[model samples]
Target chain A: MQVRKIMCACGSGLGSSLMVEMNIQDVLKKMGVEGVEVVHSTTSDVHPGAADLFVVGRDLADFIKDVDKDEIIVLQNIVDKGELEEKLRAKLEA
Target chain B: MAGMAEMLKRENVQIVEGVDSWEESVRVAVQPLVDQGYVEARYIDGIISNAKEFGPYFVICPDLALLHARPDQGVLKRQLAVTVLRRPVRFKEEGPDVRVLVTLAATDADGHIEVMRRLATMFCDPDNITKIAEANTADEVYAFFTAPIE
Candidate 1:
């Protein structure tokens, strides 16, 4: 889907979201996928076109229901890089 | 801001037998930072209020939580505290059991990004999580965080 930007979000945008953003950047680097700008912010900042993809923890998944399913990645474990890399690979490939 | 090891002082790390509820867990987690003056007493309340509003958004992974609130809530300086519960606590009726609470007090939105990055590297490994959770002393927990990332 040619994702150029990914936004990782949490309730406050200070802690968990930033962690996910870092993991995403690492995964992207390992995957050799360049040009994707991974950023972190509060859930309130999520919206259509806010980014090519919106990633959030499972608890906060309900908050981003307005976004398209294909553009959303709901993480069961916000700190699980393996889960993130697997799901992100699927999404990027699909 | 200091690195994760420097930001989390030895005195700020603790191992508690258990807590009655997740609220108590949050209180225990942030108490060190509060006592050290990194955050105002109300900062604890801020985290609880935020959890009530957002539904334990800080439980970043199973057995671990990074408790925090907005910068303006009551942050005096950016710092961290670790509370290891011998018995795990749950933030929700069906949420994952959380045993380690890493409380963060950031004075701004972006100031703690590097610290969070180091934490990301550590906590991503389940072994590291277990190492801190099962730590016998505050020094052990402190050393786990302060140790060079392999």
Candidate 2:
């Protein structure tokens, strides 16, 4: 499996984004998926070069308009850890 | 009554103290949310069950223990940080323990400091904390969170 770089972006890139990153990592591990690199970024710093996929929170969804809709993932709430993991895994495989 | 601080002061709110373990702390923190109709009682049970399966400790701090908890739910992880703020550093003798944790999802220290300052102004009254610790019902706890400190 290729180690794809995943960036979790949010308004401040500190609290919520980090939470999502941790959740994603946990889900991947539980599912026995490996070689995925997870990172965190602020909305302003998110660029195509930094990562292959951008996991964004609902509050910052508008900021990523320039990015391809297929490349960006918007989350209203990050509570369902399983759903998020599944979504990311599907994206990675696709 | 809708302000964050005001909503936190309701009378039914109880600030439980001596939450040594993560399970104990979560139970005390979610009680008011269930009692005040903010969250369903079943949800509270679910959180507890999840915590038990994944390991306790959801409060997000600089500490690595938070990461060790392996929270499967993103909302639950966020809630852990928020719950930390709701947990009372101290509990009153008369009422239920404080159940609400207000977390600042700020990334930098500056944001955390700013939110803390605002929270202090809103919920830092000596009387408010005192009365909050003594509150019995969820209504009383809600009053404490909502009431303006004199």
Reference contact recovery of candidate 1: 0.89
lDDT of 1 by residue, A1-94 (tens): 8799999999888899888988998899999999999988999999999999999998899888678999999999888888999999999988
Error of 1 at B2 (Å): 2.3
List RMSD in Å for every model shown: 1.3, 15.4
Please provide the root mean square deviation of candidate 2 (C-alpha atoms, Å): 15.4
lDDT of 2 by residue, A1-94 (tens): 2347888865445445666777777778887878889876567678766777888755467667677777887764443465676677678677
lDDT of 2 by residue, B36-138 (tens): 5545445445555644542222322111112111122222212212333333432223322333444222223132333333344443233544444455654
Write down the lDDT of every candidate, Cα atoms only: 0.90, 0.49
TM-score of every candidate relative to the true structure: 0.96, 0.43
- Which pairs in model 1 have colliding backbones? none
Q: Candidate 2's error at A40, in angstroms? A: 1.3
